[model samples]
Target: MGLIVQKYGGTSVGTVERIMRVADRIIEYKNAGNDMVVVVSAMGKSTDVLIEMARQIAPNPSAREMDMLLTTGEQVSIALLAMALQQKGYDAVSLTGWQAGIATESVHGKARIQEVDTARIRSELQRGRIVIVAGFQGISEKGEITTLGRGGSDTTAVALAGSLRADKCEIFTDVSGVYTADPRVVPMAQKLDSISYDEMLELAILGAGVLHPRSVEAAKKYKVKLVVRSSFSQEEGTCVEEAADMETGRVVSGVAHDEDIAKITVVGMPARVGTLSRLFNTLAGAQINVDIIIQSSYDAAVTNISFTVSSDDLVRTLDTLAAYQEALGFDKVEHESGLAKVSIVGAGMITNPGVAAEMFQQLAEQDISIKMVSTSDIKVSCVIPAEQTSLAVRTLHTAFGLDVAEQAVVHGI
Candidate 1:
């Protein structure tokens, strides 16, 4: 029998009926003679509700205490799903992160997994029990409760699969599979049958939201195969592996977009080499993330730098730059909010000539200006006005021939 690791998202376990549906999905795998270990997230909106409740009590709650409170959501999901499986006449047991031996870094809100002690899970499987794990939360070596940041459950599931040396990891969610673009934004977005690890990593980082970037990173590092499909359907789904089928001959695989981006520009700085390094170091000290940096030079020794950060980090980023302004030796800082980043990603584009040119030409035709640009061998991203994200995504989806004849369902729409 092959050993398998699977994870279901919040929407898949949101209600009793939905939980029952997921249990049925699990039973099919079990009956196929596979040893099963399932991971699950909190019920739909429950984590959000808990966060709002905590913020209601205090605008800024302690991260450690928040981890203690937020983990209860997944606890609820695991117990209920375990009960559901048992009621369906299957032997099942639920184990929280600590009980299952998932050890992570001491960081509370966004801890990274350090190791997995698989003795307990292996024992349970040998006893003919389906093991259920609480995803997204784990215990640190110092005995602190910690959570993987948003979509960390994907990380948890994949981590388990790698540690246990399972055959493959299956990530079931509300959406059927990874798409060329978010179906909600672009109705004609087509689902991809398969994608390479590098392409998925870019999508996840660029706000695909279908899979977590950390999980993709782990999959590549460990060489574990991943399948993303909807828990609610029997679609073929998308397979993520080291090398994907390249027979499609499509230069650009998909267009991904992220709204709620803000830009910070530091004006009039010496073109000295370490100036840029020290300036970014200031933000790094504050744990602020930077993306898409562009530098403009007026003359040989004077330059201006513009960089993008998620809007959620705008205040922190601006304050960080201002505090170091005098030390960093910049004339002034300028800021812009409500910007969006739309990117086209594909491994096939590596050998395709003029792929970025095609993207620019299409955007130019629609009069959508590109503010900041970032590129890799397989991806090109343009930051445009937030209000124009939908237009930009759809325009590029068709431009790259990623559209299907039918509309796609937008979960949570």
Candidate 2:
């Protein structure tokens, strides 16, 4: 029998009835003659509710304690799911990330997986038992519970699949699969049957929100076949595999938009070598992530450098840069919040030219002014006013022919 690893998001196992429903699906897979390993995230809104509770008690909670408190959400789901499976007459055991052998670095809030020792999981699978493991939480070498940042559950599932060499890794979530655009905003957005890992990574970064980029990287590195399906439906979901397996070469696969970005422009800096380095080094020291960097060298004497960072870090990033103002000798640092980043992703965009021009033209027709633009081989991103995000997404979705006539209803777990 083949080994299959499945991951259920918060919504899938949110309630007692939902947990039982998941158990039935797991049993169906087991009855099909496949050994199963399931990964579960925190129940719906449990983590957020816990975080709110923590905030009520303490304005600034310690990261260690916060992780300890937040991880309980997934623990609760694993136990409930295990109980549901056992009630159905199928043998099941729940294990925490640490118990399942997921080892990570010592970073408290945003730890990275160092390695996974699958001895316990392997032994349990060999015993003809369905193993349930908590996702998003892992143990550090110091024996502390650490989380893998946002979307850690996806990373955990992919990592487990890689370490176990499972036949497939199935990600069950609220959405059926990856779509050409968000269906809520673009009613005609078509579901992609297959996508390459690179395109998926770009889409994830651009706010497609189906799969985490880290998970995609892990799957690509380990060559694990990943499927995204709806927990509420039985229909076949999208498969993310290597590019060679895909037949179609559409220039645009999807449109993704993020409205949580702020642009910071360090204007009128000396154009001398290492000037920009000094400015960015300060931001790096403060642990801020900068995206979409653009530098214009007007003359040999001065340059205008601009970049984007999360809105949450706008103040901190500005303060950090301000601290180095004297050393870098810049004119001033200005920031614009309430900005959004909209991106178009496709695997075929690398070979196809004029895709960016068309994207810009469409946005212009809608009177959406683009503040900045960035392009990679497979993706194009533009920064615009946050208010124009929905309009821009709908426009781009229609421009790319993503609107479908009939909406596909998803089925099965």
Candidate 3:
């Protein structure tokens, strides 16, 4: 029998009863003769509760301390899950990230894994025991506790599967599978049977949230197969692999939207050699991420550069830029909130023409004004008013022939 690694998100093991159910699923797999390794996130809303408590204790907590506190969330999941399996008469063991040999960079709250020592995991599997390891956390080379930022647990599972050379990796979440759009938003969003690594990576990065981009990157690097399925269902999940079926069906596989966007514009900047580099490097030094940048000629002598960042980062971004104002050689800056970004992603776009044009046309037809734009071989993103996000996504989804069954649905906007 093949070795398999599985990861259950917070919602999957949100309650003690759910943990027992997961244990049963694990037993079924083990009974089938496959070696099992399971990775799990903190239980539902526990991480948020922890963060809220930390905020109450101190408005601004140290990232190191935050990492220390946050890592415990997954520790709880692993231990409780292990107990559930053991109570069910299955031999199971729980290990934290460090005990499982997950090593990471020294960075706190956003560490990247450096290596995985499979000795302990392999030993457990050899004994016919199911191993439950904590996800989203690892010890730094300096022995500091660290986290992999948002969606780190997904990376943890995929990385372990790769290191173990497991036959496959399965990501069990609340949703049954990956969809063309968020099914909650676009009720007719189609579930993809299989998606290519490139397409899935784009969708994940574009804000699908079904799987994290880091996990997809690891899967691609190690050539590991990934399946995203429902934790509570027997339905087959979406397969993420080398090639997808997009070549035959829809030219646009999905429309993705992010409502946490905020826009910042550095006005009247001299269009000199080091202007762009200096400005962005400052943001990078501040660890602020920038997305969907556009530079325009405010005048020949000065250009206006605008970009987007998370609303949470908007204040930090502005403060960082203000600190470097003279160095960046910009006249003034402006900021705007209540913004969003929406995009269409598919591998077929690489060989297809006018996809971006069609997307812009779809948004235009909905009277949605595009503020900024970014395009790649497989995707195109536009920033627009947050209120129009749902309309934009549904409009583009239907326009791309992605929801043929809902062809008669009214354009509600």
Candidate 4:
């Protein structure tokens, strides 16, 4: 029998009925003659509720205590899932991150997995028991409980699968698999059956949200085969692996868009070596992530640097730049919120000519202006007004033939 590791997201095990459904699925895998290990996120909305509760008590709760509190959500899930499986007549046992020997660094909010001691899991499996693990949380060397940050459960599952050397790591979420676009916005977007790790990484970063980027990175590094499937259905889902041949390549795999973006432009700066460094250093110090940077070389001894950051950082970023404006000798600092980033991700685009031209032509035909442009080996992204995001996404989806024969409908699980 081969060992298999499966991870269920918060929506997959959201309720008592859903937990029982998940238990039934695990039992089926066990009956199929494969050793099963399951990792689960907190029940649906539990983490958010806890966070809201903590906010109610204190505007800024201590990170250590917050970690201690949020980690309990997943603890509740694994324990309940184990009990459900046992009630269904399967040999099952649940273990928290500490009990399962997930050793992590001292970082409380975004702890990285140092190592996973698989002794207990192996022993339980050898005794013909299905092992359940609480995802997203680990214990430090000093016995302090720590939590991996948002989407940490995905990373936890991949790490466990790598350490256990499982045959496959399956991530069960609310959706069936990765799609060509956000189906809610583009109703005709189709789900992909397979995708390359590199393409998947671009999609995740571009807001596809099928799998977390960190999880995909770990899976790629460890050479673990990953499947993104729905917990409610048995249909085949998307498989992510290393690209083997050009035959599987598609011209445009998907279109991704992000609405939580703001643009900051340092305009008319005196052309100098240290100007860019000082500006970016200030932003870095404020813990703001700057994305899609474009700089114009100086002809009149003035350079313009434009970049995108999260909308929430707009105020602080502008303030920080203004604080250093006089010292940096910039003419002015301009900021705009309510901007969107639309990225077209595909592996075949690198060798295929006319892809960029086609995207630009389509946007132009629709009267959608491109504010900024960024390109990589496998993707091209453009910034546009937030109001035009849906139009751009739909236009690109149609231009690239990502639309399905039938319309797609969105429903919550």
lDDT rank order: 1, 2, 3, 4
lDDT of 4 by residue, 149-250 (tens): 878888888998999999999999877888899888898999888889999999888877768787898899999989998888887888998877324559
How much lDDT does candidate 4 score?
0.89
Residue pairs with clashing backbones, model 2: 188-403, 188-404, 233-411, 233-412, 234-411, 234-412, 235-411
Clashing pairs in 1: none
Range of the 10 consecutive residues with the lowest summed lDDT in candidate 2: 404-413
Ranking by TM-score: 3, 1, 2, 4
Q: Write the per-residue lDDT of candidate 2 for residues 1-413, one digit (tens) a residue.
A: 79999999988988898999999999999999999999999988899999999999998688899999999999999999999999989999999999999999988777889999999999998899999999998999999999997789999999999999999999999878998887766767788899988889889888777888789999999999999999998878999999989756588989998889999999899988898788888787676878899999888899999999989788778888888889889999888999999999988888899999999999999999999999999999999999999999999988987788987453422
Give the Cα error of residue 158 in candidate 3, in Å. 0.5
Regions more than 4 Å wrong, model 1 = 299-302, 409-413
TM-score of each: 0.94, 0.94, 0.95, 0.89
How high is the lDDT of residue 349 in model 3?
85
Model 3 poorest ten-residue lDDT run: 404-413
Tens-digit lDDT track of model 3 for 107-213: 98878999999999999988989999999999998999999987899999999999999999999988878888888788888888888899889888888888998
Runs in model 2 with CA error above 4 Å?
268-270, 322-331, 408-413
**Residue 265 shift from truth in candidate 3, angstroms:** 1.1
Cα miss at 112, model 4 (Å)? Answer: 3.5
Q: What is the lDDT of candidate 1?
A: 0.92
Cα lDDT for residue 101, candidate 2: 94
Cα TM-score of candidate 2: 0.94
Pitting candidate 1 against candidate 2, the one with the higher lDDT is: 1
Q: Regarding TM-score, does 2 or 4 come out ahead?
A: 2
- Quality of model 2 by C-alpha lDDT: 0.91
Q: Superposing every Cα of model 2 onto the true structure, what RMSD results?
A: 2.2
